[model samples]
Target chain A: MTGYLNIILRLTIWFLLTADLSWANIVIGVGVTILLPRGVTNVGLLKDWLRTLGEVAVAIPQAYKEAFEIMLYPHREETVVLERVKPRRTPSLIFLDIFLITFTPKTIVQRYHSRGWYEVHYIQRRETP
Target chain B: MINILSYTCIILGLVFWYWGTWPLLGRRSVLYKLHGLSVADTLGSMAIVVGLLLRIPHEWPLLVLALISLSIWNTVLGYVLAYCVTDDGTHDVGQEVGHGG
Candidate 1:
């Protein structure tokens, strides 16, 4: 199922790039997508996948909000903190987690330790009081 | 109505671009600057693409693909950059301390 989805995604990009729908184009798109090397499939839980997608959706709005906040208050303090990664997460899920974290303006993943900890760099508005 | 909205989006994206890039001139750490750059560049570029899409509905497929790639590629590139810089900084600090002692 995932393999088919991957092929479909690649073909979609191919068609978009070429902006064509002829039979010849379809055949060529399929050939290219199939010939591409596939990554190791780490079968992650469906629930986790849904959660990651939800996070991605949420990140868009959150990103806007954070951008506004940063623009409003430019004074900030920076710190490095270690965050624990959920156990048994697939590599793709982990990549999604990192992406979601870094998508916002105030935090970024600096490193992923082998022991399930992410070295996260954070920014916070400094109070003027 | 669509013309006004697209123009608004394009202007908003330009503002984001400026806001994000302005930090590079400040004395903040590299990571802080990167956070601003990545967030602004990705969101701003997406907004601009969306504006173009609204103006030219016939190019929906290409604009949508641009949006997808912008979000994913920018985020991953930011991560890779942050990782590389910090990794190198730590190694350099270690070497500096070794030489100092």
Candidate 2:
């Protein structure tokens, strides 16, 4: 009885969170079928369900943390700009570059010139851990 | 004349988007993406601005002000993020000085 109730509750929460019924329904349907109503008590499914909740809510904290970090960081008053990087031959990589640059706090994208290079200005270099 | 300019600007903006998303952006290229965004975010926005301006050229002041506000916002956002990296250094100073074994 408890296992049945868990599935129903999980289904409800999942539905509530995802407004896209068709897609969500399909996924939940397949997932439940694979796991089965009997295996509903399995810790894996329960763990995943809990994690999904966190992912939804954790975005708020993540944003706050990023913002806080940004504020507390010491940025030089001077602007360090990178000149346009002309990628020879293969030029279909601008979006990746833009997202990567914007995603990194240390780097700032200044401008992309007609010459096919993006100008980057950074106060400090950051290392990936 | 105004319509032509609007279409032209929009097309140019789309071109920027295409370039930014395609050639300018890709994996293994952080600088490219940053540069692409600068173009994609600006020129793509310019497309909308031109369209609006063409529709109501008299409202150019509003567009100008909007541009200014957006520029300020972007600048602040960039600076704020940079500040985060800088603050990390301050935290590390004590650790390095206290225990350098």
Best by lDDT: 1
lDDT of every model, 2 decimals = 0.80, 0.46
Ten contiguous residues with the weakest lDDT in model 2 chain B: B92-101
Model 2 residue runs over 4 Å out of place are: A1-129, B23-25, B29-31, B82-101
Chain B, TM-score, each prediction? 0.83, 0.61
Any idea what lDDT model 2 has?
0.46
- Residues A9-84, candidate 1: write the lDDT tens digits: 6987899889989999989998999888888656678888788888889999999888888788774766666688
lDDT of 1 by residue, B1-101 (tens): 99999999999899999989988998877888897897579988888999999999998888888998898889888889889888633622112111100
All candidates: interface RMSD: 8.5, 15.3
lDDT, residue A19, candidate 1: 90
List the RMSD of every prediction in angstroms.
5.7, 17.6
Docking class of 2: incorrect
